[model samples]
Target: MRVAGLVLAAGGGRRYGRPKALVRHGGSLLVERASRTLIDGGCDPVVVVLGAAADPVRAVADLRGCLVVDNADWVTGMGSSLRVGLGALLATDSVAAVVLLVDMPGVTAEAVRRVAAGAGPAVLAAAGYPPGRRGHPVLLGRDHWAGVRATARGDTGAAAYLRAHRARLRIVTCGDVADDRDLDVPADQRGGRRG
Candidate 1:
């Protein structure tokens, strides 16, 4: 549906001691895998937001041709990065945007596709994972862009936007997968499967 794919990879990853987006998962870096999922799910004009380790992360992922936005104010918080990323998308031709987190390596292509396909002016595609936990690659329509950009502050994310507009949210279920499985800590980067 001509949606924009935003990869939120600007975090410092202080808990993991390095950039989590470039962390190896299966055979590819997490950011690359996430981008591939978005591209496969029908998103065009994808953009990746970089911060903490922007240079090495970009080099490791080989994102030479892809659009990249630097979130120099990343230290401010996730919301700052979100605003930066969204601002970049504003210059593009995307009618809808599915914002993905670089740490979520488990977010399947099907999950992304389902969300992107259901985007609308007010309806947001919320991730329905186990225990009813909603998470990112949340699809935000162009209508919500202004409000989203205005309200983002500190660590607060689009969740505030969803809460303020609960009636407009369209929950898209994606089985038992924990699309919210973010690899912030070392244990989380280990696939959350202990032997």
Candidate 2:
């Protein structure tokens, strides 16, 4: 099955005080890293949704070999971005999408690969962390795109839809292979090393 990669990078980063997509991590922009992770994870025709500071992100992020989508309603919330990303993928031959967050610098390509493996048009999968915590790099089958778009509102992207169908959701254990830490605060950008 062909799976596309969707990177949500359209947030205003109000809490972080800057666009997370442009934020630097490990010598590269977060958006660049996220896109690379998706590509390395076996997703083809990756689509990146850009909203806040879209121009700057486009100018800086090496988005070659990927489709860049603009979300005008980004400030409304992540749902809009998710909708936009999934909508863009509708034009492709992808049967599903591996959704990743640009702020999640700790999530690895391996985790995405694991969650995307064997995903069919009706499969719903998410990366499971230790202690039964669920996180990103979620696999959304083409069959659920319409419902996800309908319920996606504010910052709650597909959470409600996923919850409604949790019984059928596949949990791919990734705690042992990847970390799902998100860069939400200034301290998170400090690399956890006090100078």
Return the top candidate by TM-score.
Answer: 2
Q: Give RMSD to native, each candidate.
A: 2.3, 2.3
Residue ranges of candidate 1 with Cα displaced over 4 Å = 176-178, 191-195
lDDT (Cα, tens digit) per residue for candidate 1, span 147-172: 99888888787878889997888888
CA shift at 24, candidate 2, in angstroms? Answer: 0.3
How far in Å is the alpha carbon of 166 misplaced in model 2? 0.3
Residue pairs in collision within model 1: none
Give lDDT per model, in order.
0.80, 0.93
lDDT of model 1, residue 170: 80
Q: Model 2: per-residue lDDT, tens digit, 1-195? A: 789999999999998899999998899999999999999999998999999999999887899989999999999999999999999999998999999999887889999999999988999999999788899889999999999999999999989999999998999999888888888877977665221
Error of 1 at 145 (Å): 0.7
Off by over 4 Å in 2: 191-195
